[model samples]
Target: MTGNPAPAAAYKGPLPRATPETQPFWDGAKAHKLMLPWCEDCGQAHFYPRALCPHCHSVRLAWRQASGRGKVHTFVINHKAARGFEDKVPYVIAVIELEEGPRMMSNLVMDETPTPENVHVEMPVAVVFDDVTPEVTLPKFRPVR
Candidate 1:
């Protein structure tokens, strides 16, 4: 399994991947917006952008703005930190269920420390950004108002 790059505060990780097909997703993140690919054929929303619609294999696709509201589906807390994030141990990593039906993996922020015990599955969250690097901004999540 692959994870997106850790933030600049945790700069030891590689930069997040932004392929030609998925550039728009990251571009929206830079502007602190959540955008995703919508299948023109099936008329549904999807993530981890692809050239064609994953459901119908339709080459014609379009992008739609996301609601940015989701629920935590699954998660783990990194008690043993990675290289760059050694200082911020015990952070919450989550698989969030977007209202539109797609699930995304990201961090839960604005909490003192996010943990499985503290962060429950099915908890509502909203998109937030951490300008981790000058060129990169992470679309993390926090408890939604």
Candidate 2:
């Protein structure tokens, strides 16, 4: 409820596996930077880093730092807990529409307990990094207060 969530001692949640395409993203997250893949051909940014641009299918892609600002396009209040998330029941899973024009799914961290009234569509948010492990830092979001 303060800022970024505290790192779990033994984080049971599924960790992200960084492949060649996503290594830069993971690295940037570790450094508290939100990096996005930009298509050199179309000059558009994209998420879920890939070798080829989803917009133009061009392999001419480059990594660039993002604004780390976005809005909650849509979200779900998960009353049910998935594996490794039992302690975080009633959490928020949101689709954030980044200012760069790409939407990405990530956990919406709240300064208060997550609830329907606490989160809403088009809510302004900024990226926060959850250092889940020494080697992995997951990018999450919190209300831009």
Candidate 3:
């Protein structure tokens, strides 16, 4: 989980469909960076970018780089793989609490099989990028080395 992830094959699962509001986040991931929408007025950050700030309801939102360090807030092991993910059964779907304070739903890539005995709440993790396609790269999390 701490080392470079095995290069993933072209992503077969649902790819992110970036809209005008979320282009920046997608672009950052393409460049192997983690970016989140930040609200200047509220001095807060948010995910799943939107036109209005969720904190202060301000339109003055901007993209900011994230530290990419967080703890696993919660997680579940998916034994049933959704289409295109059959090759990757028993994956971990986790809610990660970013250091910037926003929680995001993402797949947790680990070197070991994720189990209740190993994947625990509040486990420290860091971001990893998978270039699933030429136009899209996904940000996933892994245990910090």
Better of 2 and 3 by TM-score: 2
Residue-level lDDT tens digits of model 1 in 71-102: 99988888988776776687888999999988
lDDT of 1 at 102: 88
- For residues 1-145, what per-residue lDDT tens digits would candidate 3 score against the true structure? 2354435564578887999999999999999899999998999999878998988899999899999999999999999999889888889999999999999999888778778888888999999987777777889998885
Each prediction's whole-model lDDT (CA):
0.81, 0.90, 0.87
Listed per model in order, the count of residue pairs whose N, CA or C atoms clash below 3 Å is: 0, 0, 0
TM-score leader: 2
For model 2, the stretches where C-alpha displacement exceeds 4 angstroms are 1-8
Q: Which stretches of candidate 3 lie over 4 Å from their true place?
A: 1-10
Ranking by TM-score: 2, 3, 1
Best by lDDT: 2
What number of backbone clashes does candidate 1 have, counting pairs of residues 3 or more apart or in separate chains?
0
